[model samples]
Target: MCRLIGAVSRHRAPVADLLGDDLDPFIRLACEHKDGWGLAFRQEDGTIGILRGIDRADDSDRLQHALKHQLTDMAVLHIRMASPNLAVTVNNTHPFGDARAAFAHNGEIRPVAALEKLIDPDLLATAAGTTDSERYYLAVRERMNRGVTPGDAITLTAQAITQSSDLVVSLNAMMLTPTGLYAYAQHDPHSEVIGRRGPAYFGLSYRQEEDLVVVASEGWPQPAGRWAALPDGEVAEFPALHP
Candidate 1:
């Protein structure tokens, strides 16, 4: 139901620099995924900064400004298509998080109350939007509160969701933390999106160099030789050097 891209680099730089030409094409996907957009990155003072817009990324000057202005060592971008009933609002737009972490999810999880049952009541109360994606974030955060690593928490969260409802279209997401950018891909292969958008619609891919590593959702032009498809039901972590 969305598209996401993120990267970890050895040095702070604009997203345009980290993602290169792929950024434009990725932005273009906003034409179809035109519900809203968000970007999250580390600030110079060592806090996470998240900027979101209620307009499409391709047409928003805010997105263009952030693309060139928000420099950081780790960053994630999300363009939402929005699920059937979810409203398109700033609170519902992603790259959702607090001071330490930001998360963006690209899939739809049904009967959200099912996942909500898995999150602690106090933690679940922190959610601002009525979105399955926001609930997914809180569920992952609940696991992290118990000291689980981000990547493992993602895996566990997916398992819990499946065991409860098994209605996941895709759990694909990017979580940006101070240490790294975490990308997870988990989805039901039989989901209807495959027949409509091809087999790779829910697939994720990454390209890594010595100092830079990038992960992105498929559907655009990412060279096969440079970007390798991240396996379904797996998490990829790209660490960034601290200043």
Candidate 2:
């Protein structure tokens, strides 16, 4: 399994500040996920700035330091634990996207080869690494181009994965669009977690005072308000700006 985090805010804040103490522990946990790590942050011009490395999180102090100091309105972070047959490299890290959209995912794809036929040529061309997460992102982009909304695109992606394999999956993903943040949690048949029968845990918290919204694979450092757990098979959308 892997850990993922994404944030959308009304104001730009240091990525480090948003991550806080959670950053170190999360990075440490990511060490077990040792395949690679990556982060993508939005630029004021609406483009994305991404950094990735094949190094373990513990050795990514430089990368983390840069993100901690840089501030952006939207960001996506991922630490991957490679699945069998997948290559480990910088290009394979999460938070994959094009000029407009970005996404991060945690899970494994079964019979990953089958989905190749379902992806778009353009997306296939953008494949920088051989990882299911990147293919998943491309698949979602293709579906979106076909008029599927972001939420529907996620469900469609899940359905497509089901077609390929029966592996228990734990697809905890985050998508960043121009207008908002969208997140999803779906169980993969091949997940390696212990006691996998319970509900998949994912949470989102918004601090109005800080004008920030945080989406994490697991909740920590309990905050004051009731933390809302995203419903299974449901997508949660947070508007970029408050109405």
Candidate 3:
């Protein structure tokens, strides 16, 4: 119920190139994914600059401003379609971060309140907002805090959550680390997404060009031979762009 975009490369380019200009494609997709919009990019100082709005992407002034002006070698963008029970508020937006990483998720876990109980209570105590997606990120970060690599943390967390929850649909997500971009895509064999959304829309793909690597949800238009799908049930890691 969300769409995510991530870009990282050796050279910082105008955000518009990865997203779009006046013909904003992500905003157009927001017609269906309209809940809130958020953008997080790594700054030159090694900190994050976050711009988010509790409005549809197509309607978000901040997104418009970012596309026009911002530049970064690393960025994450999300246009949300809130799960039925979650509120459409700023705190519940996608793209949450910690000291070392930023994360955004595209799927859901059933009975989120129950799922929260499975995450580390100390970290869960620090959750700024209530949503399955944020809880999932906290769970993974807790593992990373204990020295597990971010890529493995996501895989292990996804495997554990899937074992614990029934009727779970998908677990497609992306994470931004200082040196790499990480992603995983896993789903229930019986979930309705198989018939309703199909593989083309559910698969995560990226192009590691000479200068930058870009990953995004499937519905966006991609150039011929420029994209490759991340294998299901496996984590794909794209190393930082070359200087």
Best by TM-score: 1
Instruction: Compose the digit string of candidate 2's lDDT tens values, residues 1-243.
Output: 567877777777788776655577667766477888878777777777777787887787767686768777777778878877777877877778865788888776655576666797766887888877888888888999988999889888877777665563666688887767788877743345534533343333333335767777663454557345666677888767532
The 10-residue segment with the lowest total lDDT in model 3: 18-27
Off by over 4 Å in 2: 188-210, 219-226
In model 3, what are the clashing residue pairs, if there are any?
none
Error of 1 at 88 (Å): 0.6
Q: Tell me model 1's lDDT, rounded to 2 decimals.
A: 0.88
Question: What's the CA error at residue 86 for candidate 2, in Å?
Answer: 2.0
Predicted candidate 3 versus true structure: per-residue lDDT over 61-99, tens digit per residue: 778888768877777888898988889998899888854
Candidate 2 local lDDT, residue 7: 74
User: How far does residue 63 in candidate 2 sit from its true spot (Å)?
Assistant: 1.5
Best by lDDT: 1
What TM-score number comes out for model 3? 0.91
Clashes of each: 0, 10, 0
Model 3: lDDT to the true structure: 0.80
**Candidate 1 clash pair list:** none
Taken over the whole model, the C-alpha lDDT of each candidate is 0.88, 0.72, 0.80
Query: Candidate 1 — which residues are off by over 4 angstroms?
Result: none
Candidates ranked, most accurate by TM-score first? 1, 3, 2
